[model samples]
Target: MNNLEESKTFVASLESLEPMRDFVSQTGSNAGLNKKQIYGLCIAVDEIATNIILYGYQNSGIDNGLINIHTIFEKENFTVILEDSSTPFNPLETKIPDENELGLPLEERKIGGLGILMAKESVDEFRYEYKDGKNFNIFSVRPNDD
Candidate 1:
Protein backbone atom coordinates (compact mmCIF):
# COMPACT_ATOMS: atom_id res chain seq x y z
CA MET A 1 0.00 0.00 0.00
CA ASN A 2 1.18 3.50 -0.66
CA ASN A 3 1.76 5.87 2.19
CA LEU A 4 -0.67 8.75 2.76
CA GLU A 5 0.27 12.39 2.30
CA GLU A 6 -2.03 15.04 3.77
CA SER A 7 -2.62 18.80 3.70
CA LYS A 8 -4.97 21.06 5.67
CA THR A 9 -6.46 24.56 5.48
CA PHE A 10 -8.79 26.82 7.42
CA VAL A 11 -11.72 28.44 5.63
CA ALA A 12 -13.61 31.32 7.25
CA SER A 13 -15.79 32.72 4.49
CA LEU A 14 -17.34 32.11 1.11
CA GLU A 15 -14.43 33.88 -0.56
CA SER A 16 -12.14 31.13 0.70
CA LEU A 17 -13.96 28.49 -1.36
CA GLU A 18 -11.70 28.89 -4.38
CA PRO A 19 -8.57 28.62 -2.29
CA MET A 20 -9.95 25.55 -0.61
CA ARG A 21 -10.81 24.04 -3.99
CA ASP A 22 -7.34 24.82 -5.28
CA PHE A 23 -5.79 23.22 -2.25
CA VAL A 24 -7.77 20.02 -2.71
CA SER A 25 -7.20 19.98 -6.46
CA GLN A 26 -3.47 20.38 -6.08
CA THR A 27 -3.30 17.81 -3.35
CA GLY A 28 -5.35 15.32 -5.35
CA SER A 29 -3.20 15.92 -8.41
CA ASN A 30 -0.02 15.39 -6.44
CA ALA A 31 -1.54 12.18 -5.15
CA GLY A 32 -1.90 11.05 -8.80
CA LEU A 33 -5.66 11.48 -9.12
CA ASN A 34 -6.93 11.95 -12.66
CA LYS A 35 -9.07 14.82 -13.88
CA LYS A 36 -12.43 13.26 -13.02
CA GLN A 37 -11.45 12.27 -9.50
CA ILE A 38 -9.99 15.68 -8.83
CA TYR A 39 -13.15 17.34 -10.09
CA GLY A 40 -15.33 15.14 -7.92
CA LEU A 41 -13.23 15.98 -4.89
CA CYS A 42 -13.55 19.67 -5.65
CA ILE A 43 -17.34 19.46 -5.97
CA ALA A 44 -17.75 17.58 -2.70
CA VAL A 45 -15.49 19.99 -0.86
CA ASP A 46 -17.27 23.00 -2.26
CA GLU A 47 -20.70 21.80 -1.19
CA ILE A 48 -19.60 21.16 2.39
CA ALA A 49 -17.79 24.47 2.64
CA THR A 50 -20.65 26.39 1.09
CA ASN A 51 -23.11 24.91 3.57
CA ILE A 52 -21.02 26.23 6.39
CA ILE A 53 -20.80 29.67 4.86
CA LEU A 54 -24.54 29.85 4.35
CA TYR A 55 -26.07 28.30 7.48
CA GLY A 56 -23.48 27.22 10.03
CA TYR A 57 -23.14 30.47 11.93
CA GLN A 58 -26.20 32.41 10.91
CA ASN A 59 -28.00 32.29 14.22
CA SER A 60 -24.94 32.85 16.35
CA GLY A 61 -23.91 35.91 14.38
CA ILE A 62 -20.42 34.47 14.22
CA ASP A 63 -18.72 35.26 10.98
CA ASN A 64 -15.31 33.79 11.70
CA GLY A 65 -16.05 30.11 12.04
CA LEU A 66 -13.18 27.92 10.98
CA ILE A 67 -13.37 25.05 8.48
CA ASN A 68 -10.51 22.58 8.72
CA ILE A 69 -9.99 20.50 5.59
CA HIS A 70 -7.63 17.55 5.75
CA THR A 71 -6.73 15.70 2.56
CA ILE A 72 -5.04 12.33 2.84
CA PHE A 73 -3.57 10.56 -0.15
CA GLU A 74 -3.06 6.85 0.26
CA LYS A 75 -1.88 4.19 -2.11
CA GLU A 76 -5.37 2.94 -2.86
CA ASN A 77 -7.53 5.98 -2.15
CA PHE A 78 -7.84 9.63 -1.24
CA THR A 79 -9.68 10.76 1.87
CA VAL A 80 -10.78 14.22 2.92
CA ILE A 81 -11.86 15.23 6.39
CA LEU A 82 -13.66 18.49 6.97
CA GLU A 83 -14.18 19.81 10.47
CA ASP A 84 -15.89 23.04 11.35
CA SER A 85 -16.42 24.92 14.61
CA SER A 86 -19.93 25.98 13.76
CA THR A 87 -23.07 24.54 15.33
CA PRO A 88 -23.20 20.76 15.28
CA PHE A 89 -25.10 20.24 12.06
CA ASN A 90 -24.58 17.02 10.14
CA PRO A 91 -25.06 17.13 6.42
CA LEU A 92 -25.26 13.37 6.19
CA GLU A 93 -28.58 13.63 7.99
CA THR A 94 -29.95 16.03 5.47
CA LYS A 95 -32.97 14.48 3.74
CA ILE A 96 -32.73 13.79 0.06
CA PRO A 97 -35.65 14.53 -2.22
CA ASP A 98 -37.52 11.57 -3.60
CA GLU A 99 -36.64 10.63 -7.17
CA ASN A 100 -40.28 10.94 -8.18
CA GLU A 101 -40.44 14.45 -6.78
CA LEU A 102 -37.65 15.55 -9.08
CA GLY A 103 -39.94 15.72 -12.05
CA LEU A 104 -42.14 18.38 -10.45
CA PRO A 105 -41.82 21.98 -11.48
CA LEU A 106 -39.14 23.99 -9.69
CA GLU A 107 -41.54 26.11 -7.67
CA GLU A 108 -43.51 23.09 -6.56
CA ARG A 109 -40.43 21.25 -5.29
CA LYS A 110 -38.67 21.61 -1.98
CA ILE A 111 -35.48 23.55 -1.65
CA GLY A 112 -31.99 22.93 -0.22
CA GLY A 113 -31.40 19.18 -0.41
CA LEU A 114 -29.12 18.70 -3.37
CA GLY A 115 -25.72 19.41 -1.82
CA ILE A 116 -25.54 16.41 0.46
CA LEU A 117 -27.19 14.28 -2.18
CA MET A 118 -24.58 15.20 -4.74
CA ALA A 119 -21.76 14.70 -2.29
CA LYS A 120 -23.07 11.31 -1.26
CA GLU A 121 -23.49 10.12 -4.81
CA SER A 122 -20.13 11.41 -6.02
CA VAL A 123 -17.89 10.09 -3.28
CA ASP A 124 -17.08 6.45 -2.58
CA GLU A 125 -17.52 6.89 1.16
CA PHE A 126 -19.19 9.63 3.15
CA ARG A 127 -19.45 9.84 6.94
CA TYR A 128 -20.08 12.40 9.62
CA GLU A 129 -19.88 12.85 13.40
CA TYR A 130 -20.33 15.50 16.02
CA LYS A 131 -17.70 15.71 18.71
CA ASP A 132 -16.36 18.37 20.99
CA GLY A 133 -19.00 20.75 19.74
CA LYS A 134 -17.74 20.48 16.19
CA ASN A 135 -19.13 19.00 12.99
CA PHE A 136 -16.79 16.49 11.42
CA ASN A 137 -17.41 15.21 7.90
CA ILE A 138 -15.24 12.65 6.13
CA PHE A 139 -15.32 11.75 2.43
CA SER A 140 -13.24 9.27 0.47
CA VAL A 141 -12.74 8.41 -3.20
CA ARG A 142 -10.68 5.65 -4.76
CA PRO A 143 -8.23 6.00 -7.62
CA ASN A 144 -9.42 5.00 -11.09
CA ASP A 145 -6.94 3.13 -13.27
CA ASP A 146 -8.80 3.45 -16.52
Candidate 2:
Protein backbone atom coordinates (compact mmCIF):
# COMPACT_ATOMS: atom_id res chain seq x y z
CA MET A 1 0.00 0.00 0.00
CA ASN A 2 1.14 3.50 -0.77
CA ASN A 3 0.31 5.94 1.99
CA LEU A 4 1.47 9.46 2.60
CA GLU A 5 0.44 11.58 5.56
CA GLU A 6 0.55 15.29 6.11
CA SER A 7 2.03 16.06 2.72
CA LYS A 8 1.18 19.72 2.90
CA THR A 9 1.85 22.14 0.05
CA PHE A 10 1.47 25.87 0.35
CA VAL A 11 0.44 27.89 -2.66
CA ALA A 12 -0.64 31.49 -3.09
CA SER A 13 -0.48 31.62 -6.84
CA LEU A 14 -0.92 29.60 -9.97
CA GLU A 15 2.85 29.58 -10.37
CA SER A 16 2.95 26.89 -7.71
CA LEU A 17 0.90 24.44 -9.73
CA GLU A 18 3.89 23.08 -11.63
CA PRO A 19 5.62 21.84 -8.51
CA MET A 20 2.39 20.35 -7.29
CA ARG A 21 1.90 18.52 -10.56
CA ASP A 22 5.45 17.25 -10.44
CA PHE A 23 4.91 15.92 -6.96
CA VAL A 24 1.66 14.22 -7.96
CA SER A 25 3.22 12.66 -11.06
CA GLN A 26 6.06 11.30 -8.98
CA THR A 27 3.69 10.01 -6.35
CA GLY A 28 1.46 8.32 -8.90
CA SER A 29 4.46 6.64 -10.48
CA ASN A 30 5.74 5.50 -7.12
CA ALA A 31 2.28 4.11 -6.36
CA GLY A 32 2.74 1.78 -9.36
CA LEU A 33 0.24 3.52 -11.58
CA ASN A 34 0.41 3.15 -15.33
CA LYS A 35 0.87 6.01 -17.78
CA LYS A 36 -2.83 6.45 -18.34
CA GLN A 37 -3.55 6.48 -14.62
CA ILE A 38 -0.80 8.98 -13.95
CA TYR A 39 -2.02 11.25 -16.72
CA GLY A 40 -5.62 11.01 -15.59
CA LEU A 41 -4.73 11.76 -12.00
CA CYS A 42 -2.57 14.68 -12.98
CA ILE A 43 -5.24 16.15 -15.20
CA ALA A 44 -7.87 15.85 -12.49
CA VAL A 45 -5.60 17.37 -9.92
CA ASP A 46 -4.64 20.23 -12.19
CA GLU A 47 -8.17 21.12 -13.14
CA ILE A 48 -9.55 21.08 -9.59
CA ALA A 49 -6.57 22.73 -7.97
CA THR A 50 -6.50 25.46 -10.60
CA ASN A 51 -10.10 26.32 -9.89
CA ILE A 52 -9.52 26.32 -6.14
CA ILE A 53 -6.51 28.56 -6.37
CA LEU A 54 -7.82 30.90 -9.03
CA TYR A 55 -11.43 31.31 -8.01
CA GLY A 56 -11.81 30.09 -4.45
CA TYR A 57 -8.75 31.72 -2.95
CA GLN A 58 -7.58 34.43 -5.30
CA ASN A 59 -10.90 35.95 -6.21
CA SER A 60 -12.47 35.39 -2.82
CA GLY A 61 -10.22 37.89 -1.07
CA ILE A 62 -7.87 35.24 0.25
CA ASP A 63 -4.24 35.99 -0.45
CA ASN A 64 -3.02 32.52 0.21
CA GLY A 65 -4.26 29.19 1.53
CA LEU A 66 -2.67 25.91 2.46
CA ILE A 67 -3.32 22.81 0.33
CA ASN A 68 -2.52 19.44 1.80
CA ILE A 69 -2.51 16.35 -0.40
CA HIS A 70 -2.55 12.75 0.74
CA THR A 71 -2.28 9.69 -1.44
CA ILE A 72 -3.52 6.21 -0.62
CA PHE A 73 -2.85 3.11 -2.65
CA GLU A 74 -4.69 -0.07 -1.86
CA LYS A 75 -4.67 -3.33 -3.73
CA GLU A 76 -7.16 -2.11 -6.28
CA ASN A 77 -7.46 1.61 -5.77
CA PHE A 78 -5.36 4.72 -5.94
CA THR A 79 -6.65 7.76 -4.10
CA VAL A 80 -5.61 11.37 -3.97
CA ILE A 81 -7.06 13.48 -1.20
CA LEU A 82 -6.81 17.25 -1.51
CA GLU A 83 -7.64 19.56 1.36
CA ASP A 84 -7.72 23.32 1.06
CA SER A 85 -8.43 26.12 3.49
CA SER A 86 -10.72 28.05 1.22
CA THR A 87 -14.31 29.12 1.46
CA PRO A 88 -16.81 26.32 1.80
CA PHE A 89 -17.67 25.50 -1.78
CA ASN A 90 -18.10 22.16 -3.48
CA PRO A 91 -17.11 21.98 -7.12
CA LEU A 92 -18.87 18.67 -7.58
CA GLU A 93 -22.14 20.40 -6.86
CA THR A 94 -21.96 22.12 -10.22
CA LYS A 95 -24.90 21.20 -12.35
CA ILE A 96 -24.14 19.41 -15.56
CA PRO A 97 -26.49 19.95 -18.43
CA ASP A 98 -28.54 16.96 -19.41
CA GLU A 99 -27.70 17.26 -23.06
CA ASN A 100 -24.27 16.46 -24.49
CA GLU A 101 -22.81 19.93 -24.52
CA LEU A 102 -19.45 18.89 -25.83
CA GLY A 103 -20.98 18.06 -29.16
CA LEU A 104 -22.18 21.63 -29.48
CA PRO A 105 -19.93 24.18 -31.02
CA LEU A 106 -18.23 26.71 -28.77
CA GLU A 107 -20.55 29.39 -30.04
CA GLU A 108 -23.65 27.34 -29.33
CA ARG A 109 -22.71 25.75 -26.02
CA LYS A 110 -23.19 27.41 -22.69
CA ILE A 111 -20.19 28.79 -20.93
CA GLY A 112 -18.36 27.05 -18.07
CA GLY A 113 -18.65 23.54 -16.55
CA LEU A 114 -16.49 21.81 -19.13
CA GLY A 115 -13.43 21.63 -16.91
CA ILE A 116 -15.30 20.27 -13.92
CA LEU A 117 -16.93 17.70 -16.12
CA MET A 118 -13.59 16.59 -17.47
CA ALA A 119 -12.10 16.33 -14.00
CA LYS A 120 -15.02 14.29 -12.75
CA GLU A 121 -14.93 12.04 -15.77
CA SER A 122 -11.20 11.40 -15.61
CA VAL A 123 -11.37 9.40 -12.40
CA ASP A 124 -13.29 6.34 -11.32
CA GLU A 125 -14.24 7.97 -8.04
CA PHE A 126 -14.55 11.64 -7.23
CA ARG A 127 -16.03 13.08 -4.05
CA TYR A 128 -16.16 16.43 -2.34
CA GLU A 129 -16.52 17.45 1.28
CA TYR A 130 -16.37 20.71 3.14
CA LYS A 131 -15.69 20.43 6.85
CA ASP A 132 -13.94 22.38 9.59
CA GLY A 133 -13.79 25.39 7.30
CA LYS A 134 -11.82 23.49 4.72
CA ASN A 135 -12.66 22.12 1.29
CA PHE A 136 -11.77 18.60 0.30
CA ASN A 137 -11.67 17.02 -3.14
CA ILE A 138 -11.09 13.29 -3.14
CA PHE A 139 -10.12 11.78 -6.49
CA SER A 140 -9.50 8.12 -7.00
CA VAL A 141 -8.88 5.53 -9.70
CA ARG A 142 -9.92 1.92 -9.44
CA PRO A 143 -8.40 -1.21 -10.93
CA ASN A 144 -8.49 -1.58 -14.72
CA ASP A 145 -8.20 1.54 -16.86
CA ASP A 146 -9.87 4.16 -14.72
- How much does candidate 2 score in TM-score? 0.88
What is candidate 1's local distance difference test score?
Answer: 0.82
Q: Give the per-residue Cα lDDT of candidate 2 at 89.
A: 76
lDDT of each: 0.82, 0.79
**What pairs collide in candidate 2?**
none
lDDT of 1 by residue, 1-146 (tens): 56766657675688889999898889888887888888888888889888887788656678767888888877677898888888778888788877977788998987768887877887788899899888888888887653
Clashes of each: 0, 0
Q: Name the 10 consecutive residues with the lowest summed lDDT in model 1.
A: 2-11
Root-mean-square deviation (CA) per prediction: 1.8, 2.0
Q: How does each model score on TM-score?
A: 0.88, 0.88
